[model samples]
Target: MIQPLSMRGRHAVVLLVEDNEDHVFLTRASFEEAKLQIDMRHVDDGAKCLAFLRKQPPYEDAPSPDLVLLDIHMPRMDGYEVLDAIVKDDALRHLPVIVLTTSAEALDIERMYGMRCSSYIAKPLDFESFTKAVAQLAGYWLNLVVVPHRDG
Candidate 1:
């Protein structure tokens, strides 16, 4: 349901926090067919996600992402912790974050919403379906919605 608009606007940066390499690859592949230009970065864990957003040591020069795709379960820190941190941080709270996880439990979805995530999506098991879902999601959020500029 995406309207065909000029996809040449400012490149939207997306940070994907996923520990699974295969899921990361699938997301990358899905973006290949996007109608809008996007700059996607991948972090393996919640801790790294926070680090990337905070411009910490290794990620000091990392740009602030317009959107974030977060995974629930990760070593060191979980998505809940990252979400908590984001909500608490004055600099990062305004950024939109979408929860991407395998759990479709009502509690999980509710909890994510309670934490003020922009959206909650469960990963599809089928590759084709997964790709399609991601495409649709990307289309809706990136193409249809207006992304706000991040103030320094």
Candidate 2:
């Protein structure tokens, strides 16, 4: 299992905002296979994601996530809008948001970077490659990088 950051004093928490069920399943399985000891939460759309982050109504008891994995395509609201909201919010701006999507368009990449997304990862076509990528990603964030401590 991955060690929790010393600053956080507990297991890492991650929020995954994805509408595709298949992607969600694969992501969850990948983390499990890697034995990452993280609290992963899921929300299907941008609106719900925002609500969860803001701790509104149904998500009033939601934990503040250390990182967010966002998908670009979704109904109602898109990843760009959600990122914008997060960057603009004073309380939420410190969170890291990584874009994990199928699109690898130059324009999309440039736009996400312009909006201050922490990282952008295009989903691999093959299942094995995707699994490997997810493992690498988890290792990088959980073990390699230093992230801010989020109080519950």
Using alpha carbons, what is the TM-score of model 2? Answer: 0.93
Q: For every model shown, what is its TM-score relative to the native structure?
A: 0.90, 0.93
Worst 10 residues of 1 by lDDT: 1-10
- TM-score for candidate 1, residues paired by index: 0.90
Residue 103 shift from truth in candidate 1, angstroms:
0.9
- Prediction 1 global C-alpha lDDT: 0.86
Cα error, candidate 1, residue 142 (Å): 1.1
lDDT of 2 by residue, 1-152 (tens): 32445235577888999999999998988888877788899999999999999999799999999889999999999999999999999889988899999999999999999999999999997778888998888778877887765565
lDDT per residue for candidate 1 within 1-152, as digits (tens), equals 22222243557788999999988998888778544477899999999999999999799989888889999988999999999999999889988899988999999999999999999999999777887888888888777776565634
lDDT of each: 0.86, 0.89
